[model samples]
Target: MTVLVFLDPAFADGRIVDAGKPALMATDQGATRGDGIFESMLAVDGKPRKIHRHLDRLASSAQSLELTIPEPEVWQRAIATALAAFADDGGGGAAGGGGGGAAGGAEAVVKLVVTRGVEGSSAPTAWVQVSLPPEAGRLQRENGIDVLLLDRGYDSTVAERAPWLLLGAKTLSYAVNMAALRHAHSNGADDVIFTSSDGRVLEGPTSSVLLAHAEGEGGTRVRRLITPALDSGILPGTSQSALFGAAKAAGWELGYGPLVPEDLFDADAVWLISSIRLLAPVNHIDGREIGTSDVRAALTAELNELIAAT
Candidate 1:
């Protein structure tokens, strides 16, 4: 199987050749040990959606870690060029031609990973890699996904203790994140949601949670879309942002605040959003059946419209 990867420096050859060895520094080999940042992005219609936002987040993460990155234009060009090649090779296709059968009809996932450049014996290596297209993100969106709540928390205290905790940064060190997802799969769930040891809902292992308002308060009826607050220590979700905007444009009220497990059940709708999954309507949580609520149809319609417009 040929693996499609974006070389940091552009290359013409599609196949991986010994001459195209990655310029990996010693620091990237195993010098520094801590959280490394990373970002997962998606390509729609053969183009990345909100590319600047993802890049902005990447730059911020690097800055927080005191690491430098290629200029925005350089990075953008590298990614764009690679995607164009892939799209030509059946990844997506020339833009505006429907790009059919290319990773779910011109929709693909592009992941960006950057590490701190080697700094002395104590510095970690800096590197970046972009995946061709993520099939998993596509699968989850097509078919509803099941999620299990892990009692383990991301250690909120670490965010302050190690300012470079990489939680906010899109670091490269993601062994724990991968392990959490595996843990969920091993337990019969398609994905995992992290929660505080004390039962405070955090986020999914790879997506953000959006809860629907079940009841209106103070004579103001809450509409369809809702999510946890940014201060709640959740990874800001790109798809959720788009969904919120769509809901608002369609006259739906979107709320953001802290929510509990009970809130998930009480919510008119519950979804896990991310670059890949887009929006996955959760059918069940734990062993209980959700989506039986009154707002199920409205919420489903709202999600369908959002996808159609996109």
Candidate 2:
């Protein structure tokens, strides 16, 4: 079951609506023009993870779209109401929040959405959705996935030259992203890692690209995690940022890059990280195996532990 909570000014805790009924107007720009912003987060045992970070990104997206939304505190209250309702309705029963992945804990996916509302209405339609994450995400996290590297049709400099592209903002416009995933699926791949037209490794359709390198042996070993630079027109990954912090505290080095596919191939291991899927190891990319199975399993376990702490 899904829980819906509309952020109405008339209600201090948000207005709960029936999910089975029609709540959105047909003319809402979010539905018609994909003009809006959204953030999806993981809630474990009724507590949201990285909520502040998600809210901050939501605010940034709103600024980019020039669309006003309810304040962070308002969103927080609505999230609470939604999660409570979802649990009470039995949506949060025995299944853990790991989305059925290796993380395994009581979990729910919480989505915050705001649209331009009906044409000319001026008031944005905003709401929170609480529900179970797809089992496919969990399965991908467990068994790993095969990916295709596809050109995104834009150079890394596109974000700087075209601010209107909203490259840095997580908006409702995702037709291209979804199409890329479908293309990967049609080609016998489980997912996609988009590359810039200029050959820089960007990110996945709904995740962030991360590569790791290990040097030395035994006591002298050094492990480092790296991700593409934010200036490369990719959405900032909250999960990656949180993992980097946890990893660093555990003595793992960190770095950012203008990486290419070769970097992925050269790394000891690579993964596509996100809020819902968590950290899914990429077993192969474009038919080439990533790191050896032993190495990948080791690194994945180490990182999963760090993620659990986060």
lDDT over C-alpha atoms for residue 128 of model 2:
99
Error of 2 at 198 (Å): 0.7
The positional error of residue 136 in candidate 2, measured at the CA in angstroms, is 0.6
Specify the poorest-scoring 10-residue window by lDDT in model 2: 95-104
lDDT of 1 at 140: 59
TM-score of 2: 0.98
Can you give the lDDT of residue 144 in candidate 1?
A: 64
The whole-model C-alpha lDDT of candidate 2 against the native structure comes to 0.92
Count of backbone clashes, every candidate in sequence = 13, 4
Instruction: Put down candidate 1 lDDT per residue, 251-297, tens digits, no spaces.
Output: 67777766668888777677787776567777778866676644555
- Superpose all Cα atoms of candidate 1 onto the true structure and report the RMSD in Å to 1 decimal: 4.7
